[model samples]
Target chain A: MDICDLGIVDYEDALCFQTDLWRKRVEKKVPDTLIMVEHEPVVTLGRVADESSMIDRELFEKKGISVVSTGRGGNITYHAPGQLVLYPIVDLAEKKRDITFYIDFLEKTAARALNRFGVPAGRDEKRRGVWAGGRKIAFIGIAVKRWVTFHGVAVNINNDTTPFSGMHPCGESDIRVTSAKEVLGRELDMSEVKRVFAERFVEDFGREYSSQFVVRSS
Target chain B: MGKMELRLPEISAGGEDVVITLWHAGEGDYVASGEDLVEVSTDKATFDIPAPCYGVLERMIKKPGEKAKTGEVIAEICTDDI
Candidate 1:
């Protein structure tokens, strides 16, 4: 497995890259991969996302935040620079061919990674993401095709959560959103978070992550 | 010719049930081996089940949105080769 770091890219560009990698992975052209990327502020809708979940749409437009609908299964979520999005393009046929287990693995992987940063994040039994201090700190929405996985979990490291107030996070309007910086009361280095997450995934999931491409935001 | 059962695959461990979200091949549809035959969703994720062998989808024991246990037969396919 390879972990490719593509820093601070547009959300659509990252999705396009994920799609290409997903195809390659399904076709057995490349090894399983985990892509870590930070997106330019945007709000995305998952497969089951509802437009009514956005409480204030005009506010997002004025702030230049784009709304996009995706094929991943889940609800609405926000992304921005400072957040670490891990898209794991893996062939499940090569591992445990269970969708439920894969989803749980993703949540557990993020929670374990956050633990390394001294943030005690865990999953809410009724929810689908990682939470800390009674607020969600990570979100997961993934899709699988031909037993291969794509679209993955995102952890809020030091990203802005103010925009999240305008929309329901994963269709739960009452949900409070937080970040690693918010919990620790300090700004966190995005690259460090990415590195910790990559290492934690390898440790927790027992997969070899090859470091091939590393890009940093200028 | 005999009918081969298309069992609800071992979707997960611990014997959890999954909901059949959709059936790509209806009864009487000729499906090729390795082609996607149905879609099933667990609590958080959705995945497709491919045809086990080239045959005519003779019967559907489970429909969309129906709950099925892992390893339970969900459909049957009539094949001369088998």
Candidate 2:
């Protein structure tokens, strides 16, 4: 699989770009690709999200931020510059068409990445996403068409956590949001972090599905 | 002066379709931008869709608990002003 790192981009533009690329793949316009990037501080409402998911819309508007309703699965989550978002435009039919297994693999990859950073992260029994110390660090939301995957997870690394306070993250009002920087208590190298994450994703996904696809670094 | 169909933005990592679970507003109701328009459910979770633009909801082609395929028009917003 080819990995393309898009760097930092506007939230809406990134989503739009991914959607367009996803369409092209579905229509056989392009080869299956994997995209990685980060988005500006934006509040994304997921497939099962509601207005109640946001703590204060007025507050977000006052700050000149945008709220987007997306088709990805999961609740509301914050994506910002320090967070790494991965969009794997892969044909799931070539692998396995199990949605549940895909989600599990994503969680496992995220948790493994966190573990490499010396932080203990795992999946919650009842909740989705990867958590560290009972606080969520990575949020997963994705869509699949004709077995091709688009959109992906956002792992908070060096991102500011203040904006997350404006929403009831993942639509769960009781859950607290955390980041790798907060857990590590220092800034992390973005390139290095992405390398580790990409590696983990490729390793875990390949092993689970027994696919021979290599994770290309962007 | 024409009606614009409002479709669900693509959200799946695999780019799959979502199902309309509920309609927060009814047909003929006025909705402001960012207001809840409909609810969608996927395998991972259910999501509430917000109005993309401020206008009167002209019609709801899909009802509650109905399957809303991606890029399919679930409703239309009548925009005479813009």
Highest TM-score against the true fold, candidate: 1
TM-score, each model?
0.81, 0.73
After superposing candidate 1 on the true structure, give the runs of residues whose Cα lies further than 4 Å from its correct spot: A62-64, A207-218, B1-5, B22-30, B55-67, B72-82
Poorly placed runs, candidate 2 (over 4 Å): A211-218, B1-40, B43-63, B66-82
lDDT of 2 at B48: 57
Q: State the lDDT at A29 in candidate 2.
A: 77
User: What are the per-residue Cα lDDT tens digits for candidate 1 across B1-82?
Assistant: 7889999777666667777777888899999998989877655566678999999999899987688998899999999654
DockQ of each: 0.41, 0.12
Please give the distance, in angstroms, between residue B60's alpha carbon in candidate 1 and its true position after superposition.
6.2
Tens digits of per-residue lDDT for model 2 on A6-120? Answer: 8999987887888888778867778767688988778888777888888888878998888888878778888889898888887777776656667778888889988998878
Give the docking tier of candidate 2. Answer: incorrect
